[model samples]
Target: MNQLNVSEFIATSDFRRFHFLLLIIGFFCVIFDGYDTAVFGAILPSMMKEWHLTAVEAGALGSYSLFGMLFGAFTFGVLADRYGRKRMVAVTVILFSLFTALGGIAPGPKVFGFFRFMAGLGLGGILPNAIALLTDYSPKKTRTTITAIVFCGYCLGGMLSPFIGILAIGNYGWRIVLWVGALPLIFLPLAYRYMPESSFILLREGRREELLAVLARINPARKIDAEVRLYEEHDVSTRVPLAGLFGEGRALSTVMFTAAIFFHLILGYGLINWLPKLMLEAGFSMNSSLMFLIVLQCGAIVGTVVMGYAGDHYSLKRILVGMYLLGSVTMVLFALNRNATLAYVLIAVAGVPVVGAMNLVQVYISQFYPAFVRSTAMGFSSSVGRVGGMLGPLLAGWLVDMSFSIHSMFFAFAIPGVLSAISISAVQHRYSTDRSRKGQAEVGMRLAGEVEK
Candidate 1:
């Protein structure tokens, strides 16, 4: 009886072993997402030469994937809320894995583009679910830190893709690179066997037994408190209405949040997708261009970890605004300075703040919404960003095709960075006002109930 009690206590604790395991799983999934997204950019130059494609054509192929991601993100957001996070994650992973492998076997650019777009759909669905799942398991105090650390997987994958592309393309071909990219499929079985559904979701669904089961698996050494029971009561309204995010006082804030994601992603994805080509056009060799891209991503990884800490300790909004300003200034400097060494240094500096800002935005979005609508909010915001991401590469490709100087293209990208700074600043201001209003309203309600009693 004592041993059973110990086992139950261990399983029900808030800081359970299963929670960390889930984070690891999420980290791996996101790493694959980063690798798949970055690999195309790394191999684009070679693919163009082999297929006799123009810059515009390649950009279209890139946009095709983003378009697919938009659909996937939106669809999975709704499905995850209506169905379950685990189910949606499983479906999306399988979808992306199969399509990513198929991309290697494409007979032409058209076929390849279709496969990439399909893969994008899976990519889109996986991330929001991962965020929701991780958030569910994470302790409140360490939530932001854990989320940011997990996201570093994205940066690591992006940084490693160029090296992988360089070696694989040289030894075999771009097709082989795509084939190897599908290796993430190996994780699906693990997810199926080991990944627990969100405890919150279980409580929401009124499956108390299942919730207890998961809690036991996660935290095998704690007493279940009355607070845990309270969670079930509050989670009774788990079926979130899709329009609820825009209803009540949430409409304007939701729109602004969506716009903020749009502009940030435009700057982030535009810079990432075009960095290698931009460096090459600036007279760097292919190998050097790839190296510079790697440096940029390495900076991003460091920035993400640092900013994650800052977000928890300081003002997230202030950090986000400052990072944008830093990115804009660095963009202008990179455009002006043609020296390869100096350019690499500037890009690295710029990348630190840019990726840091992006990571914080994801963390902020996850925290802003209640658990009931968290996945929906993440999905919608990410989908809107995907729209911007879809357009960014295409727009840059158009400029490149029009014979615009690489310096001019960098300046164009910098405009969005500046705009993002302004947009996010406005969002921060509005958020403060909204918070104040909510606080006052709550106080008023409490006073009214006291009077009635």
Candidate 2:
């Protein structure tokens, strides 16, 4: 008779069509997530003009959604851990999609801000939940690469926003670009149907039949006879999900991750929300400024693929540290750049570390905690990071208002990249749950891999 450990089975399973479906779905969902989040930056210039706003007010306005994300990430993480990932994903998609469209129709800044804040709640919740979903299903060996591929949808969305904005804003106005956000609501049903439930949920509920069915689908070549018995590899912890994030020797690392996310977002949002304004201030036309965003995002997409593959093959931590270092250098170079061709290249490199590196950080935190608390860990870290993200645009606005030269401004932004690298380096990797599980999963893989839904 053969005995089965469900977690080990899924972790060790071979790649299948079902796994590919999840990857494709995860990729597209995050693409929409990227689009909705980046839309605000796209419209920021127009909002400044129509609202008769100063740089400070516009930055403050951008922070409203960040506030919503802070609350949403924590709240959604707890709920996803308790209820399930798929349900929470649906709730957030609808929440952001509807309110984002509403923002387009808002009569004034107050109304627009309110709508954005509401949408921010959804935006805040989306990535953590989506990543958690993929983390649960992807094979442990290729998890970093798989998750990174799905995560790139975010940069792809960032790229999409400016391209669309340049075209539509000329005739249809910024509002038309936002109205496109509502498109995701149409795919909600298909996602709801196809998205797999967390195997943890099924195993916890003791749904042996359904769990077995999913395992069969995960590895169609595998067979289970009547002689086999199945067991969950890791039982659900009775302890509160948030509490677990700080337990099991994770407190220092959790704080370190939170801080790293904080600095990353500051650099990311500062560049994302303010780069166009910076370019425009340097005498570039609005379209040219927007084109810079597209180039930056393209660099992010390339960086994400390269770094993900490198992290998988080399040391994940080392790659992250190097990326942060590289990103900071790019910013300094951008400050000294005189040639247009070189400036474009510099902006692209900045995106690699500023935006692309965050995806790897997500991979790290997701793998750090136990399955029971993964979402909570990601959410709490992201929510706290949202505080920094909230401040990024506002800080940039203040920086722009000051009497400093553009050289000084780029130098200031580079500081956070260095801080982010330091934070990651300080994390205590000895306590990571993923490290412990890797050898165990590898052993189980040699036993012909476990399969799950």
Steric clashes per prediction: 12, 2
Q: Model 2, 399-438: lDDT tens per residue?
A: 8888567778888888999999999998998888867666
Off by over 4 Å in 1: 1-16, 225-240, 428-453
Write down the RMSD of all candidates, one decimal each: 5.3, 3.1
What's model 2's TM-score? 0.95
- lDDT tens digits, residue span 259-367, model 1: 8778777777777777788878878887777887688888888888888887767777778878888888888887787686787788789877667677777787776
Give candidate 2 regions above 4 Å deviation: 226-228, 438-453
State model 2's lDDT. Answer: 0.84
Candidate maximizing lDDT:
2
TM-score of each: 0.89, 0.95
Residue 255, candidate 1: how far off, in angstroms?
Answer: 1.3
Steric clash pairs (candidate 2) = 9-450, 9-451
